[model samples]
Target: MMKLWGRDTSVNVQKVLWVLDELGLPYERIDVGGPFGGLDTPEYARLNPNRKIPVLEDGNFSIWESGAIVRYLAEAYGAGKLWPADVKSRALATQWCNWCQGSVYVDFIVNTFQPLIRVTAAERDSGSLAAAAERVGKAFQILDPALAGHDFIVGDELSFADIEIGALMHRYFTLPIDRPALPDVEAWYGRLKTRPAYQKHIMQDWTTMKIPGA
Candidate 1:
């Protein structure tokens, strides 16, 4: 059996979990990081030098970084399901996966989520939060058109790109912020919600991460 390390509430960890479930791969998950607080240990450091959550151990092989783990699982196990068989299609999927991490994740987590959820109301900077929201919204605007005629990021079928980007949809929609009207993006999110794996892993309650009254 494979082993995974991370807390369930972590969005990065949830991305890996979603992929594992989607591929029907069996794995044991050990809680660490965040309030669980096992990341600083030497053993944990050996698993992931960055001390990040969501490390995957397959027998003697170990892989860290949520995006890499997701891609590894999809390519190794999912093939035509999550990993696109065509070279060009796979490239496109990888492109969106990187875009989600590079463009969407930073602004959403640092500028928006941390300010609104992790910080106290008195400490929250409305200006920065609003700016982040705008930037994230613009990022989604680029995505909305790409999803206009497609149900998933790459094509009609679910792909690694969806798992990478859709992992953040729950937070993006649930966060208390002004969002521009994005019909295609909203429709894509609705499609993702219909998946059992997505619902189980991505739709989890995240109130634990939020400060009281936040």
Candidate 2:
């Protein structure tokens, strides 16, 4: 059995949970971090040196980093569903995943969210937050255009790429931030909203997010 450790409301954790749901994979989730707060313990650190939540433990294997863990599952178990096999196809899938982690994650979750929602207003870095919002808005423009004719991020089927990017989309729409036009992103999200597993997990008030405007 796969065991996940993180709070339900956490955006990082939500991504992992959302992926598991998409793959129809069963796993046990342990509440940690945020309100739960077990990430700093020696036992927790034994799994991840960074002491981050959303660690995935399967039998003797343990992996950290939300994106990596989701990818591992998709590659190992999901295959054609979330993990593409062909070189070009897999590259395309991974392209969106990398963009979510590198570009979107940095702009929305890291810069703006870290300051605005993850920390209190008094403790926030206003300049960085505003800059992050600008970058994210620009990045969304890139996605909005690509998603114009497509229902999902990559391939005809719903892949981990869609699952990965959709998690960030939920966070972006919820935040009190100015956003660019994203009709396609909106449509894509509408489809995701219909999933039973997404409704079961990912949607809720954040309990321990440190961002300010949240």
Candidate 3:
């Protein structure tokens, strides 16, 4: 059986788990990182030099980095669907996947989410949060138009691009902050809720991550 090392609470780890569940692949998930606190060990370091939460072990082969792992799984198991066998379609989907990590995640998740959930009220910086929110709004404005006629990121069918971007939707909608009304984005989010894999993994309760008054 395949082995996955990471905690359920981690967003990066959750991405891998969601893919696994979507593919109907059986794997043993070993709790690590955060409160589990096993990421710094020598054995874990050998698996991931960056000391990241998620590490995928398939027999003797090991892979780290959430995005790479997701890509690997999709290529290895999910063809003509989640992986997108067509070259042009795959490229388009990959573009959105990269966009989510490179652009959306940095401003929305790293800056806004980290402060609101991880940092206490006393330690929070209002200026930084406001700046992050502005960036997030701008990012969503770009996304809203891209998702105008498409139910999913790439097309009508679910793809890895949807998996990557959809993972952050729960936080985007639920977080206590002023948000511009992007009807297309909101409609896309509603469509995502219809998926079983997304419902099980991405739509999980995140109240524990939120600090008081956050």
Candidate 4:
């Protein structure tokens, strides 16, 4: 059996967990991070020097980085499904996977999400938050056209790209900043909620985040 070390609430960790659920791959999870901090420990650092949550160990291979792990799992265990076998198609789908890290999640995390993490501690920055939201909204505008009529982000079929974006979308919906209305965004997100694996692993209660007004 494979072993995964990370916290359930971590967005990055959620990515891998959703992929595992999608593939129906059984694995053991060891809590590490947040309330249970072992990331900087010698053992944890050896596997992932970055000290990030979600490090996967399968047989003799140990992998770090949430997105990379999801891609690997899809390729190794779900070639035709989460990861398409076709070259061009796979390239297109993978683009959004890479986009999610720098585009969708990047701006949002820098803005609203940062302040929300230490809510009761008082570090809200209305100006910066609004600016970041504007940037994030612009990215959504790009997605709006891309998702015009598609159920998933990549193509007609579900892929790791969908799962990656879906996890980030979950955070946006739960963020303190009121969600901007984007019909296409809403519709795409609605489709994800219908997926058994997505709901089971991604639709977590926001209250647990203890993100103040959450």
| Superposition error at 37 for model 3 (Å) | 0.5
Would you estimate the TM-scores of all the predictions? 0.98, 0.88, 0.95, 0.92
Question: What is candidate 2's TM-score against the reference?
Answer: 0.88
Evaluate all candidate structures by whole-model CA lDDT and list the values in order.
0.92, 0.79, 0.87, 0.82
Candidate topping lDDT: 1
Give a tens-digit lDDT track for model 4, residues 37-137.
Answer: 99889989999999988999999899998889998999999987899877887898788777777887878765667666755545566777778887887
Candidate 4, residue 81: Cα displacement in angstroms equals 1.1
User: What's the lDDT for candidate 3?
Assistant: 0.87
Q: Which candidate wins on TM-score?
A: 1
Ranking by TM-score: 1, 3, 4, 2
**lDDT, model 1, position 1:** 99
Write model 2 residue lDDT over 49-123, tens digit each, in one string. 898878999899999988898889889888777887777877887898888777788777668766765577776
Q: Which should have the higher TM-score, number 2 or number 4? A: 4
Estimate, for each residue in 19-58, the C-alpha lDDT of model 3 and write its tens digit. 9998999999999998889878899999999998799998
Give me the runs in candidate 1 sitting further than 4 Å from their true place.
none
Runs off by more than 4 Å, candidate 2: 121-127, 207-214
Per-residue lDDT for 138-178 in model 1, tens only?
99999999998888988899999999999999999998898
